[model samples]
Target: MRFSVHSVSLWLCAIPFLSLVGAQQYVLHHLFDHTNFFDEFSFFSEPDPTRGVQRYVSAFEANAVDLAGFANDAVFLGVDYTTPGPWRRSVRVTSNTAYDSGLFIADIAHMPTSSCGVWPAFWMFGPQWPYDGEIDIIEGVNTQDKNKVTLHTGPGCSITNEGTVASTTLKETNCNAGDAYLGCTQATASNDNYGDGFNDIGGGVYAIQWTDEHISVWFFPRGRIPDNVESDSPDPSAWGPALARFNGGEECHLPDHFKKQSLVFNIALCGEWAGRVWGDNAECSALAPTCDEWVADNPDAFAEAYWLINSVRIFQAHEA
Candidate 1:
């Protein structure tokens, strides 16, 4: 996206004039405000690739079901709650353009709650599945109280969570093609980071900084967002330790694994993750014999299945 010099000048004037030494400054590259959200993104009108019990609809269908619209100055993405569907109706949107490296920040007021058969995510992926890599930034499945951040790449790519917080646990170490399906996952300890606990606290901001050296994720509750973020000059160095960090040096090369990836946001129902673990979840398992059965029968259970996004901003590293 090309920004006029006037826009850049305005941003520079809004923030401090000087740049920090030994630190990188990110400039506002793309600002996806609620007003032009639908126009900026394209609806993914196809079957769920994961074979989930979901039917992705077009923008027109989403409008008809009141699934996608602006609510209270924020963008609302929701699923069909009242309709009795053999496959639940939902919406998936992909950004018009792709990015290589940048600081991606999402200001959310509410996200899909951790229900019995819901799988929601705000993630990114390349055209090539494992070859180009995928990043699951804010993702989790059924009845999960905490957020699970993961990375999926082709053969030879791996990461080490050496700089992550103590509360974050590494579920797997090798991020190769074998592990790509499941990938290298790190689960955040805070319940407030995702699901029902997150919504109860009025939601917050999730920032992801991707560079050649490392990929890091940080979560800030509603009132605790960094001042620099609001000023459009985010400095990840001052954000303390990230909740999850993937430092890829000699073990894996980032440019080889990650490429031009389009930003995506969607809520899938009873798919690979949610359906596979259905019987294990006592609360969810008690509702039906299978995940698909429960989702088809109880449509009202997903009344809280929606995303209330205030904004999504992308920042590119300012050249020195």
Candidate 2:
């Protein structure tokens, strides 16, 4: 896969400013292969013994989702069970505030993700998307042509991207960063975008390296990663070429604008992003190509919809 080298430097040259902190220096939880503990799966879950309303988690507020309406909060996602759904679930780690220099890695082994209306995302966000900010480290709609890695901020922020059927990278800046939130497509993989290509070959790792000057990212399959490149702030010296790049110099006005972002792992079925793909699934059930249909037609692939999360770990490098 020969990514456009011309596109890379072009993105690098466009960014007037950057935050290259390089490698995290401390550990917050060091969550990798832990079995159990308080901070281990610290994101609250439904308490046992009680089986009714008490099993609901009313803390987090979802826009259209009603807390008590579903089977239980645990149905959404809880550490009690091996999976996060009555039928299926993905661990969505969220941070009220974003992290500055640490690195986050979600080792997701996806199932048949090529089906329609099944939008699974391993990404992060600020308090208010486009308002606080949204970093879609790895997100692709149901169609899967462009595996998009974008940064969303209000006005003041804008970006430029470059890539083809192989990969993409972007440099961004939030100049005015208006009151309302906005987003920009930072990096993407053209051929390897996000579709049959990624799922077919095998799900890979998506990384975001945010610094004071720039944010660089790379994706690697579990099998492709070398032994030395295992840690966060991976030795990019061995990193494959970045797929996309966006410039933020003239656009980004706030320096600490993208400070803290929480980790979120979710399999949002036919919602905003995915809804756009197959259509408003909920609104247009008959027309919308929902996963339910796939489950019936292609049971084998639909089984993969059960996203397999091997592990989600974060690592920080010591300062020089």
Per-residue lDDT value at 286 in model 2:
54
Q: For candidate 1, what is the TM-score?
A: 0.92
Candidate 1 residue lDDT tens string, 203-318: 99999999999889999999888897666578888888999999899988888889998889999999888999999999999999999999998999998988888988888887
Model 1: how far is 230 from its true place, Å? 2.0
If candidate 1 were superposed on the true structure by all CA atoms, what would the RMSD be? 6.1
Taken over the whole model, the C-alpha lDDT of each candidate is 0.85, 0.44
Error of 1 at 302 (Å): 0.5
Determine which window of 10 residues in candidate 2 has minimal summed lDDT: 2-11
Q: Please write out the lDDT profile of model 2 over residues 198-269, one tens digit for every residue.
A: 656555666555555455566676578666456533454455555544444654643445656676554444
| Prediction 2 TM-score vs. true | 0.61
Model 2 spans with C-alpha error above 4 angstroms = 1-29, 34-91, 95-98, 160-182, 190-196, 231-233, 237-240, 279-302
